[model samples]
Target: MPEHDDAKADAKATGAVTPQGSGRASKRPARSAPAFGAFVRKEPVRAPVRENTQANTPVGASTAQADGLRVETAQSWPADAVEVGAVIEAYGLKGALKIAPHAQGGKALLAARRWWLLKGREQPERHSAVRASAKVHGDSIVGQLAGLTDRDTALLLRGARVYVSRADFPAPEADEYYWVDLIGLDVANEAGVELGKVADLIDNGAQSVLRIEYPETGKDGKPTTGERLIPFVGVFVKTVDLAAKRIVVDWEADY
Candidate 1:
């Protein structure tokens, strides 16, 4: 969710936070958080995109436009980059892009000054500096990427996923955490009974819930697996030790 100046090590932790692996972060004192905001949860919604008449264009244009919005290609990707949202389509005539931020409401995107746009998982990513960006329609964001002018170029960016370096994200308030920071941490009960690792989080309109998966021995003494859903409330989640890579809760394994 945030970072300090330990440069290289922080970069590795950024890439490791993706779904396939886990990352370790320094521990912070556990405190009672009464409310949560952008770091908590945001549901995805369809953005209202305006149609444009410009034709398709490629990302490798060499010339800079008169207004100084240059389409410069990045030579390398930032190690701290993390996917945040995707461009839906062109909005208006002056190169504005309609974006559908990920489940977290583009909190990181809103805070970032630059963005990396990827066409696909295998393709190389391109970089764009932000000229202006704002949240629109409650769940979506409309942004103007520097050097990207005209509706045609904006159309070419449709479906391009947007990424921002984790270091660029704003720090969460005490007792609050970004969902990305909680995923993959081990969860256990007060009595130290292993429950599972956090696989994902769910927003049930009222609050966030932890989705944990773990292995167990069935009544027949055979190995089995099960999922547990625990509300991420202070009453249940007692302590979160990111340095120790575990969470202590009041929940029971059977529950």
Candidate 2:
């Protein structure tokens, strides 16, 4: 995973932002994300699987029709849905798509059976049941949607952003955590001095780094801004309690 260089202005500080497949759980120093996608689920919140009914047609079936397509809006999206990648182009003579996965890579996409696609920011979003998906060379993904069978149809989907439900994401291993889960957790040193909340994380070849944002106080006792880039290794990150939304580290705020 590449580092998120830009600070997220709208980073969810507190909420049920469980980890999806894009990021791996942080445990020890030098702990790398698995070759496949890594995601974690906070039990009891299963991904919603709405069956097709007369009152409500399946999302894909309805979106196929021009009239149904107009009804799509942000409100129709699943609460757990997270953008994972985008369709860059059509692949092969057969109906297949080339995907440019977000920083987390295609692990979550590979594990998902269905995918949501959006053409543009304000455009309606639609779901496509996946028939097959595979990781390919160049850190990309090649996938086949159930109803698509020709290159022409696949080309039409180019530039569409892909999203997967967090509920559908597979669980992480012991001591592992999803990146989403750590984003808003509070950070404190061993002495109990408040540092800041996690702003984001980035992969620095060997390990993930936590970008923390705290407040800097001036000589007059006015609060300013402070940022810290701490390595997420076990050496620095002593303990992580997701339920408590707190992380105890070995470093001090001034350092």
Judging by lDDT against the true structure, name the best candidate: 1
> lDDT score, residue 181, model 1?
78
TM-score of each: 0.71, 0.68
Runs of candidate 1 exceeding 4 Å displacement? 1-58, 61-75, 122-125, 217-224
Q: Model 2 lDDT vs. the true structure?
A: 0.60
**What are the runs in model 2 whose C-alpha is more than 4 Å off?**
1-72, 217-223
Tens-place lDDT digits, model 1, residues 25-67: 2374544433332244343444355464332344544423433
lDDT of 2 by residue, 1-255 (tens): 222222122222111122222332475444433222123221121123334232122334444443212234467677888777787766788767777766444556666777778764554546445545454435566777765666755665666777788776556545556677788999999999988999877665445678899877878899986789977765567788889999888787668
Error of 1 at 34 (Å): 4.1
